[model samples]
Target: MSADDSVLLHTEGRAGYLTLNRPRALNALDHTMVRRIDEALTAWEHDPAVATVVLRGAGARGLCAGGDIRAIHRDASAGGGASSRAFWRDEYRLNDRIARYPKPYVALMDGIVMGGGVGLSAHAGVRIVTERSRIAMPETGIGFVPDVGGTFLLARAPGELGTHLALTGAAVGAADALLLGLADHFVPAARLSDLADGLAGAGVPETVARHAATAPGGELAAHREWIDSCYAADTVEEITERLADSGEQAAKEAAETLYTRSPTSLKVTLAALRRARALGSLEHALDQEYRIACAMLTSPDLVEGIRAQIIDKDRDPRWTPDRLAAVTAAEVARHFAPPAGPDLGLGAGGAAARDA
Candidate 1:
């Protein structure tokens, strides 16, 4: 589909609708899609006729899988990092905008919403999930840290649940998402169409109330005791040790999952989550993520991870340092340094320095 067709836009009475339209790719977001969505929001923000905004994806599989990693893989492999950086600049800005949108932004997070998908929906004023919803920020598996204000959201989740999810790249169901504060309401998948239709004439609160139902019991709450205890450690190594000795099957599984991820990414992701907690604002967290994203462009793991997971489909990424012990503090610290170009500057002050 063309750029315009990638995101379908329309209006229904008082509601403006934005639908992610690339079903074949599970509506995986790209630079063009981000720009288009931002432009639509800008137009609707100023239009008095538009009282609310709604977002959804086109296909049955999911709202969005994540960013176009294949594209990033190609760019990083070719030593052309500028294009990917530009995409992140705009994408992060759009994420900040969603968090502060004036109009009631209602996100229909109905299916698999991972990585960039979480960024698009989790920050909205009203986030709705369903039985089909499987939400996560699974970036570490691809040797990347979560961007688009993901660290900000993850850092704020109760206890160390965020750390567990971040390290394991685990996809949670509706109830777990709600417990994590990543989503607001749970609506049955069968009633999502009705909920969308109701928004056309009714206010957001009433429309959502009509369909919202109690979410089924989640898995995380039961594991909170173990998760909080194991992930509370200061270092990933300590965390792993705690998990392995905790005797919880789930904690042990989480440790095994970490062993398969890029060691450098695990270390960086842990640092990012801790730093995001101190940053205390979505804009600041986004700015930090921008720097890390630019740094990843030059990291061999980003390219190799994507190659193994997506391009080559071998599922075996040979990380540069390969071991957690080998990823020095200096190496992890480098990702936090100012990028080569103009900083995203979203958190420098209250205003965005770079134009979106």
Candidate 2:
């Protein structure tokens, strides 16, 4: 479909609606989709008739699976990575805009929301999830660090829960998403239409209250004891070691999952999450993510990871440094370095931005 069709936009009573319209591709966002959404937001921001903004996906599968990784793979494989970097530049800026949007921005985060999907919904003013919702920032699995303000959001999650989710790239259910602060309310999938309709005439809080229900119990709380103890380590290597020796089956499984991801990504993701904790603002975290994203475009693991997970479907990525120990501090540190070109500049005057 054309870019305009990819993101269907319209107005309903007091609400302006953005429906991500690529169900067949699970509404994977492209640069055009990002720009279109941004433009719609710009127009609606000053429209007095647009009291609220609602975002949802057209397909049953999810709001958005992520950015067009197939395109990213093609760009990175072609070696220049210019197109991919440009896409991230706009995409990340859109994420920052969503976080600070003036209107009551309500995101219907139903079904599978991962990577860029999380960036789109998690930063909104009001995030809604459902029983079908499966939310995550599964970037490491694709040899990427979580961008789109993921590090900022995940870093603020209680204790080491974010750490566990980041490294393992695990998808969490509605309750877990709520616990992680990724979502604000739970509305059953069947009632999502009712909620959307109600949004047209009523205030967001009232509409959501009428539709929202208690989320199904999540697994993370039960595992928090083991998760906090194990993931609190200083490094991915240490975290894995702790998980391995924790004697809990879940911890053991988490450690095994970490081993499957790219070693360099695992280390860099850890560093990014740690640094995000101190960055203090979404803009600063986004800036850091942009730098890491550009650097990753040149990494062999990014290409290999996309090939294994998306293209070849072999599920076997041959990372440049096969083992976690083989990834050096200097290599991990390089990801945090200032970009050779202009920085994202979202946090231009902030102390974090100055330091970065």
Candidate 3:
């Protein structure tokens, strides 16, 4: 692999590892990177010499913070294009492949793993967390809906913890990731090299079994009781109401966070999660998410939300609905509606459809 490679692909003995190289941007996924990652995985999947696949980020601060939001912002600002559509279609396909790969795929999830980062790693067979792992979906904060199969994972989270995390862009540390079943193993950052060595020497299954022994409890472990109780509500409104009513400091803080996010995003996210819960597979979940994502780009909140947050660097986002309750059922329903055209020319209407 060369320095120009978006993902540094290499093989040591029977192990093939893909290192996300964009540390400056926290390994954020751009269109090129997404395509390369999928290509590497496809190659390694059939290689007789490769026994396992390892995914990691080059920088110490973040495995990947999210997608290249600057690109999305550019697209939304420039009024959409064939290129932008192609980006989402291909990116979603890569996410799907990771979720369904046959080989044992281990993600070294350290530092910030959010948005696009989650899409790449969360679906792996072995998600290994370090104490440095700080994870979230966080798309709501930027005016984008959480795609990358996040809807499926969020819907599957124990209770309303998913909804709370999504709406608030709440960060969860290593212990919490494991407790939430987001991580399969936990190892100290210092042990990452050793884990890689173990995987290469002993093969993936055995390595995973050993690593699982060292897995630790995460942030969600502490709040399980309260999270389960408060997050039981079916709707985001009800969930917010429960959080507001709770006397606990944690619950109150969560409520405040959710209240601060874009109202339109929170509403669409809740609906996406619920719809995902009823779906059959990760691809199905991403497909549902794509519909909402495409719709969001055309909606008022997205570009303005990005302008207020990332482009302007102002923390305040002026949401259209103002409050979650202000968003009507019809307004929310629009996000899930199909795009006007013949499937956007995405082929097959199969698992890959979500990707394109």
Candidate 4:
């Protein structure tokens, strides 16, 4: 499909609606989609007719799976580093724009929301989820650190739960998302269409309250304390050792999951989370992430990870440092280093414009 066909835009009454249209691809974003979204949001920002914005995916499967990474893999194969960088830059700007948007933004995060999906919904003013929603970052599986303001949001999750989630690329259902502060409202899947039809100038809260159901208890509750203790360590080595020593089934499971991911992705992700916690704002975190993303474009394991997991379907990536211990402190440090280009030009006035 053409780039313009990827996003279907519409307006009804006072609400502006966006339907991610590539159901076959799970609406995986490309540079064009990001640019189109930025353009639309910018125009709608000043239009008094648009009092609220509603965003959702078209298919039953997901809001979005992620960036068009297979496309990026193609670019990597052709040595199109500059093209990959451009895509990330535009995507990051779109993310920043959403975070700073003026109108009341509502996201129907009703299905598989990971990577780019999280970037789209996590910053919305009114984030909605349903029983079908399965949210995660899951970038480490592709041999990359989370980006598109993921580092910023994940850092603020309660205790070390964020750390555990990021490293493991584990998918969590809607209730778990609410517990992580990744979602705001829990409306059932059946009522989503009704909610959109009923939205008028300023009635979203009341309408949502009427539809909101009591979400099922989060699975994280069972292992929160264990995750907090084990993932809170200063280093990945320490965290794995602690988990190994604990003998708790959950802790052992977490360590095993960590081992399955690319070691470079894990170590760099840990450093990203650490630095993100100390950063000033989402823009700051995105800048840090932009650097890491640029690094990912150059990593051999990224190509291999996608080859095994997505291309070949073997599910076995030969990461450069195949073992965790081989990923040095300096190697971890390099991913956080400043990029050769300018920082993500997200500007200084966004956070004030949009409420966190």
lDDT of 1 by residue, 1-356 (tens): 66799999999999999999999999999999999999999999999999999999998999999999888887888847988998999999999999989999999998999999999999999999999999988888889998888899999999999999998899999999999999999999999999998999999998899899999889999999999999999999999999999999998999999999999999999999999999979999999999999999989999989999999899998998888999999999999999999899998856636343
Residue 314 CA displacement from its true place in model 2, Å? 0.8
lDDT of each candidate versus the true structure? 0.93, 0.93, 0.80, 0.86
Candidates 2 and 4 compared by TM-score, better number: 2
Tally clashes: model 2.
0
Against the correct fold, how does model 1 do in TM-score? 0.99
Which regions in candidate 3 have their CA more than 4 angstroms from the true location? Answer: 1-3, 209-217, 341-348, 351-356
lDDT of 1 at 111: 90
For candidate 4, lDDT tens digit of each residue in 213-270?
A: 9888889988888889999898888998899888799889888888888999999999
TM-score of each: 0.99, 0.97, 0.92, 0.95
lDDT of 2 by residue, 1-356 (tens): 66689999999899999999999999999999998999999999999999999999997899999999999999999848988988998898889889889999999999999999999999999999999999989999999998999999999999999999999999999999999999999999999999998999999999999999999999999999999999898988999999999999999999899989999999999999999999889999999999999899878999999999999999988999999999999999999998887888888755443333
Write the candidate numbers in order of decreasing lDDT: 1, 2, 4, 3
Between candidates 1 and 2, name the one with more favorable TM-score.
Answer: 1
Query: Candidate 2, residue 311: CA error in Å?
Result: 0.5
Which candidate achieves the best TM-score against the true structure?
Answer: 1
TM-score of 4: 0.95
The C-alpha local distance difference test score for the whole of candidate 4 amounts to 0.86
TM-score, cand. 2 vs. native: 0.97
Q: What tens-digit string does per-residue lDDT give for candidate 3 at 1-356?
A: 35457689899888898999988778888888888888888899899889889999997788898888788888877857445566777777777778778888999998899988998899998898887789998888877778888878888887777866777888888877876668778878887877887877687767766655454555666676777787777777887888889888899898888887788888888888777888867767766777777887787788777788778988888888787778899988988778654343232367345444
The backbone clash count of each candidate, in order, is 0, 0, 10, 0
Off by over 4 Å in 2: 349-356
